[model samples]
Target chain A: MNVVIGIDIGGTKTKIGLVDEKGKCHIKTFFRTREFPDLDDYLDKIKSVSDELVENLDKKVTILGCGIGAPNASSKKGTIENASNLVWKGSVPILEKLKERMNIPMRIMNDASAAALGEMLFGGGKKMTDFIVITLGTGFGAGIVANGQLIDGYDGFAGELGHVDMTIGDGRLTGLGVRGGLEAYVSATGLKRTIMYMLSKYLVVSKFRGISYNDLHGEDITKAAEEGDIIAQRAFDYTAKMMAQALANFTAFTQPEAFILMGGLTNSGKWIMEPLESYFNEYLLEVYKGKVKLLESSMDGKTAAICGAAALIWENEKS
Target chain B: MNVVIGIDIGGTKTKIGLVDEKGKCHIKTFFRTREFPDLDDYLDKIKSVSDELVENLDKKVTILGCGIGAPNASSKKGTIENASNLVWKGSVPILEKLKERMNIPMRIMNDASAAALGEMLFGGGKKMTDFIVITLGTGFGAGIVANGQLIDGYDGFAGELGHVDMTIGDGRLTGLGVRGGLEAYVSATGLKRTIMYMLSKYLVVSKFRGISYNDLHGEDITKAAEEGDIIAQRAFDYTAKMMAQALANFTAFTQPEAFILMGGLTNSGKWIMEPLESYFNEYLLEVYKGKVKLLESSMDGKTAAICGAAALIWENEKS
Candidate 1:
């Protein structure tokens, strides 16, 4: 069985796993991302852990390829363009650096795009020829798969659905040189902003009050909604509506088979799912109304990225 | 050389042509669409015209295929769903009917889609893999080609760029369910409406006042614009701005090599092109900025449908 290393790099943690041609994952490893002073150090730590695992095995395994998923990884440039979370400031040549270190073929793509490929190759969208994978996390991200291929557009920035102006939300500052975008209202910050707006509007008090958005986390909001918190429910509802509108607009151009929602924030489950499903259907054109299935990511937490990044190698081999 | 019979059925006219493998169109024919009372009559007229053309040729030119481009033609369903402009009242099984009559394989697609295929096979996009063809004629229309193949979406309803919202003009009604679409502000009706608005706002003469908009045409507006009419020029500018915004949104999804503008309205040249080129650049995301080109379609007032529809047969042979 041809096996490949799948690495997922995130702001808080990093996940590494071995995925085979059958899309099955083997022993997995995790580490805090902050410990490494630089990207090279981080890569070295990953290599050391992998080498140890390979040595411990009863027989030497044949590693065919490597696939990495990072926040701003560019498939066209084979680089990780300045991710706000990572230590790297500018365009970091990830694929080339990894190739030099490891004597195997390596491919890198954006995490959301990797998730899309994972869904396409092994998960919910396996039977689908066209679909979109939306990551409802820190920022709403999208990976578009059209006609059985990922759309990288002209500069590999084709699936930037989050930045499409669904409605100019309260002007919020961001590094991408825009104050308001669809991401501002539907992402994690958008959820926090919604909570604050509802609290101000309804004059409500909450246990999660006074916590910075980053500290509160998506799960906390989910917990609040599950506990029947009116403000939290409202926040989820608002996000779902905006999300539906954005998806509806997107459907106008590329009608897909399904929209797979991923990331930590969508863990809110029914609070977000039910409303998004209802509104997305409501706004969809008659032809597309019942056609698109809304699905949860098959990969969860570290496993999601692991499977997604791993699937990249599986796909590269086939293509 | 393999050849196919290509037919474009429109509201008032039908265009028929014989297209060979090399995209060479021979012996073009045209007739009033209303001359036929039923589908059989239309097919008979096509057969007679086609028979007359091929009879004189020394080679026994067996028509290898038949391709049709019509409004609301569903490539997936092999039918032309009832178009409001056509005399037909319900879904017409055009492909199957034509195939049986000609004893040849047949395919049908929406006019814009056929135009996109035409551009891919024979027009400005002949040398390119991915491009969008926007037909600015009686209605706002588009055909998108990505990854060297036409994007039919899930239900064969992709590339509806004309239906995207217009930010500059009064929310105009469109044939599609959506209001304020690009069609409302950029097509023939859109141009007339803009002229009417200008007349009310700027023109004081009764000669250009209180006339039903249906009475005015794109030619009249073009003549006015050519004569340096301020209101007419502003109308063109407004149309260009709205179109540019729509194109910007489209580029967000599939970054094509260029946006090829076709159809009647595009004939206005600089009046439409200048604003569109400027605004498209201004609104584009940083990554796609200055990357996508805007070009005029070579198939103007010609058998674009014939060329594109013929391409279907030619494409099948090559594959």
Candidate 2:
């Protein structure tokens, strides 16, 4: 059996897992990403944690490679470039530093691209040649695949679906400071914005009405939605409408076989999916109607990111 | 020396050319497509005209294949699906019928896709692996190239840039019966719509203000703009703004090295291109700003369509 170490590097936490070839996590561990500010110490921490996971594996498996997925990662340069959320400044030679500690056929890519690779290799996109995997977290990031290849354009910065302008005149601004962008209306942050808008528009008594901007999280909205909170439900519906319109536009661009949704907001389930499907079908071009499908990522749960990261190694191995 | 028969099928006329390896047309001829309503007769007429053009060449040359770029074409199924503008109803087996007469390795695709192939093989996109060719004619059609391949998607119905909904409320509807589509605001028809809007809104005296919607054509607007007519200039500026926003959105999707403009709207020259370049730079995402170039298609002139059509053969031959 061949297994690879999968690392999911986030702003606050970094998780490493012993991932089998089939994308299942046998063992996993996490460390505070911000705890070690020094670059060399961070590398050492990652190596120790990864080594322990491999040693803890019950079966004697060959460690083939390691794959890491992070924000602002540049696969072409083998570095994470100016990630706004990370404490590390400038272009961090992460892959090089890690390779020094553990010499393996490792690879790194944008986190969203990693999720797309996961979807292709082990999730709903298996056997599918063309599709888009969207990560709807703090922002709307996507990895678009066509001809069974990732579209990492001229500078390796292709597939910025969230930033695709699907704006209504008075749409909110995104974290990137772009106004009227799709991410401004469809991301986790966008969902909160929707909830806030609804809270002001509708006079309905909702549990979220008292919540402050800093206090609100996507999970609270999902919980409220599951309980049939009117404002929360309406917020999800509004988000879905924005998402559907954007999906329709994206369909016109690539006309992918399926659109797989991932990350925090997808937990809303029927509240978003139902409205999204109907609106997407309603807005789709005449020829594309009843053709493309909208699917939620099968690679859900905490270990999903790890599986997605590990997929990078397996994908490269095949190529 | 080798050559290919290039056929550009249009609603009114069909042009046939003997295109050499370098995409230069040696000789060309045309026949009214509407004259022969019968599909069989149309195929016969095409084959006979093609034969004459091939024979007229004085120099000895090998006929490699035949390529046709028509509305509503399908390279996968070898048919022209119900093209709303074309006389043919339902799926007409264009390639199969044409193949029966010539018996050469023939292929047919959507005209826009053919133009994109032309770009890759002979035009502005000759050395580019990733680019999008926008054909702004009566409608906004496009052929998107990414990862060194045409993004024909799973259904081969991808790259519908015209149909992409970028609607602000009150945006005009396209021939596809879709509102807020890029075609509604960027095509030749769309330019007239812009002119009409400008006429109604602006009190500035202009020649086009007296013309009816039916009487006003894209050429009139271009001519008026060249003469420094305020309404005409404003219309071009408005069209460029809409087109720039659409292009910026498209950039977020594929992030190409350049956007090659083809078809009628590109002929407006500086009236549109100057403003388009300005707005494209202005509206482009920070990551993509100053990177993508807005290029006019090098395949210009009466022979342009023929070159675009012949490029299909050369593209396939390369593979």
Candidate 3:
């Protein structure tokens, strides 16, 4: 059996796992990402941890290589470039530094792109050659797989569906300073903003009227909507409408076989999925109607990142 | 030398040519497309024209195969399905019918998709592995190439950039009965409509003031803009703005190496190109700044369709 080390670098914590070819994680561990302020320190910790995991394995397995997924990572350059959430500034030559420590091959890519590979290798997109995976966490991210290959684009910055402008004018501004961006209204933060905006406008609102902006979360809104709260229900509807329109536009471009929704917001389940499917079909062109399927990601959230990172290495090896 | 028969089927006329592997047309001819309402009649005409062209070739050459470009073509099924512009009503089994007669291999794809392949093989996109070609004719059409392959999608309707809805409210209706589509604002017909709408709204106008809606043409607006007509300039500006925004949205998705503009509208030159490039950059995300290039198709308009059709066969052979 052959195994690969998978590392997922998040804003707060970094996950490490030993993943086999069958998409199974044999061992997993984590460390606080912020603790290592310097890039060299972080790389050293990763190497030590990986060595310990490899030494403990009883089976005679060859460790092939390492795959790392991080925010704003570039697969073309093997660098993490100007990621806002991370303490590192400028482009970090992650692959080169890791290569200096280990004689094995390595690969790096954007976290979302890795997740998309994970979906294709081990999750809902196994049979789908062309599809999109959208991650709705604190911010919105997307991964596009076309013709059974990930589209790294010319600069490895493709699949920024979250930054696609959806509003006509005077729309909400995203953290990226762009107004009317899909992420401003489709992510967990976007859902909260919608509920707050609705409460301010509609007098028919109920329990969410008094809640402060900081205190409200996506789960709160989902809970309220589940209990038949009109305002909460409307917020979910609004989010779904925006998402559907964006998906419609995406369908025109790539015409993927399916769209896999992942991360926190998907927990709302039927409330978001139902309207999303309806509006997506309604807004889609006549030819594209009933052709694309909307799906949910099947990877467990806690381990999905690691699986995706491992899958990246497996995908490269197979290709 | 090796040659292939290339046929470009249009609503009004059908272009036939004998093209070499180097993207040069040796002999070419045409016939009215709508004259033969029946599929069999049209196929017969195509066979005769192709045979005549092949017979007249001066140099000794081996005929490889045949490639056809038509509206609503499906490469997967080798059929043209529900093409509104064509006289044929339903699906036409173009490849099969032609193959049965010629005893040679043949392929068929949408006209726009053929154009993209042509650009890739012999025109502006020869060096590009990933790019999009937008054809701004009476109706808008697009063909996308990703990772050196045309994205035919699951249903062969992958590149429908023209039908992407741009307006939030009541927008100009397309022939497909859809409103606010990109085609409604960027094509020649769309340009004339914009000029007419401007004349109706703004009191300060020029030569176009006296012209009725039916008599006005896209060239009239281009001529007036050249002579310092404010309304015409604004119309051009408006069209560029809408096209730029749409291109920006497309950039976020495919992140193509460049966007190649073809057809009648591009003749406006810098009047359209300058603003398009400016606004495309403006709307693009910071990471994508100065990354994507906007270009004009270098192929002659009259010969491009034939070149594209021929290139399709070459692309198939090479792959």
Candidate 4:
């Protein structure tokens, strides 16, 4: 069996895994992504850890290449440009440096795009040629696939669905300082903001009454909603409605076969999915009613990112 | 010379022409589209007109095939589905019937999609592989090209940008009864409604004061705006702003190389284009500020439809 090394660089930690062609991870490890201030030092540590993992493998396998997924990574330029979350201050020549050190083929793309490719190959999107995978993490990110190929657009910035404006006036402000963007209403941070807004606007009694904004998390809201908290339920409803509306707009443009939901929001299960489905159907045009499917991603959250990175290599090879 | 027969099926009349490989229409003719209630009769009349045009061509040419562009046409199913503007009530097997009559290769696609193919091959989009063509006629229609290919999506209904909701409230109602859609604010009909809405909402005095809603047209507003009518100018401003916002949102999604404007709205020239360009810049994300170009279609409107319908066949042959 041939194997590829997959690296998923996150704000807090970097996950490294050896992924086989079958989309299975044989060994996985992690290191603090923000600990190293120097780019070369970080690459050295990553290479050492990957070498040790490869040495310990019980079965004989040919190491093909490496695939990396990171914030703001551009496959076209082979550099990570000004990723706000990462400690690296400027554009990092990741592909050039990695290839110089490992002497093998390597590729890089934004994490969201890599995840979409992973879903298409190994998860719920396996059978779908035209679908969008939306990652509802701290912020919203989208990977758009059309005609059985990922849409890289003109500048590899094509699938920025999170930045799409959703409101006309005084809507939630996004990190990008744009008011009423979809990311302001649909992400984990957006859900927390929605709950805060609901609490301030409505005098509904709930368990989250005393929770401070900084202390609140998406999991906390899920727990509270499960325990019959009205504020938390309202928060979920608002988020689902906004997401459904955005999805409806997206449907009219691309007419995808389905929309696959991933990341923290999907953890709420039926609480979010049910409302999302109903509102999406209501908001959709008559021509598209009951045609598009809403699906939950089959990839495991912990290893999904690593698998997605590795699948990039597999996808490139197949193409 | 090799030529192809192009047919553009409109609600009022059907335009048929003989087009050479270079996209030049040699001869053209038309007939009332609704005169025959039966689908076969309509197709037969179209065939007869096309045959007459082909026979009358002064140059010796090989008639390679036929291409049809109609509202709600499906290239995949070889049928024209329910078109609100057309007299046809259900799906019409146009490709089969036409192929049976002409006995060459035949293809059919929605009018907007055919127009997009035309633009890609011969109009403003001749050099652009990634761009969007917006048809601002009575209703809004869009054709998207990404990665050098048209996005037909899963059901051949992709690129429905007109129906994308632009507001969350009771904005202008669409012909489909959906309120606050992009079409409701940007199309010729939408512009009329905007002017009407502005007339009732604002006290700005202009030549439009005496015109009833039934008597108003897009050209009237254009003529008034050109003559320094504040009410007309405001209407143009409002329409351009909404269009710019929608285009910005679209940029975030597909990040096309340019956006080509066609039909009556583009006829306003700089009046619409200047404000549209400025507002589009203001609304676009920083990364995409000066990247996408806003262009006017070069194809003549009267013959553009025929050329677009013919281009579908030319495009298919090359692909």
Segments of candidate 3 deviating more than 4 angstroms: A55-61
**TM-score of each predicted structure versus truth:** 0.91, 0.96, 0.96, 0.97
What local lDDT does model 1 show for residue B263? 84
lDDT of 3 by residue, B91-162 (tens): 788888887778777888888999999999989888888899999888889999888878888778788888
Which DockQ value does candidate 4 get?
0.79
lDDT of 2 by residue, B1-319 (tens): 7998889998878999988878899999999999999999999999888878878878887889998888877777888877888888988988877777888888887888888988888888878988999988888888989988888777777788887887744566778788887888899989998988988898999998688999988888989988889999999999999899899888988889999998888888999999999988988988778889999888866887888889888887877
Off by over 4 Å in 2: none
- Residue B129, candidate 3: alpha-carbon lDDT: 82
Most DockQ-accurate candidate? 4
**Per-residue lDDT of model 2, residues A57-174, tens digit only:** 8888898899998987877778887776788988899999888999998899888888888888888888888899999888788998888888877777788778777763456776
| Clash count in backbone of candidate 4 | 0
TM-score of chain A of 3: 0.95
Write model 4 residue lDDT over A174-273, tens digit each, in one string: 8877888899899989999999899998997987889899999888899989999999998999889999999999998878999988999899887798
Quote the positional error of residue A109 for candidate 1 in Å: 1.6
- Rank the candidate models, highest DockQ first: 4, 3, 2, 1
**Local distance difference test, per candidate?**
0.78, 0.86, 0.87, 0.87
Interface RMSD of 2: 1.4
Candidate 1 off by > 4 Å: A32-37, A56-60, A82-85, A168-175, A197-216, B35-37, B56-60, B165-170, B197-211
User: Candidate 2: TM-score?
Assistant: 0.96
Candidate 2, residue A197: CA error in Å?
0.7
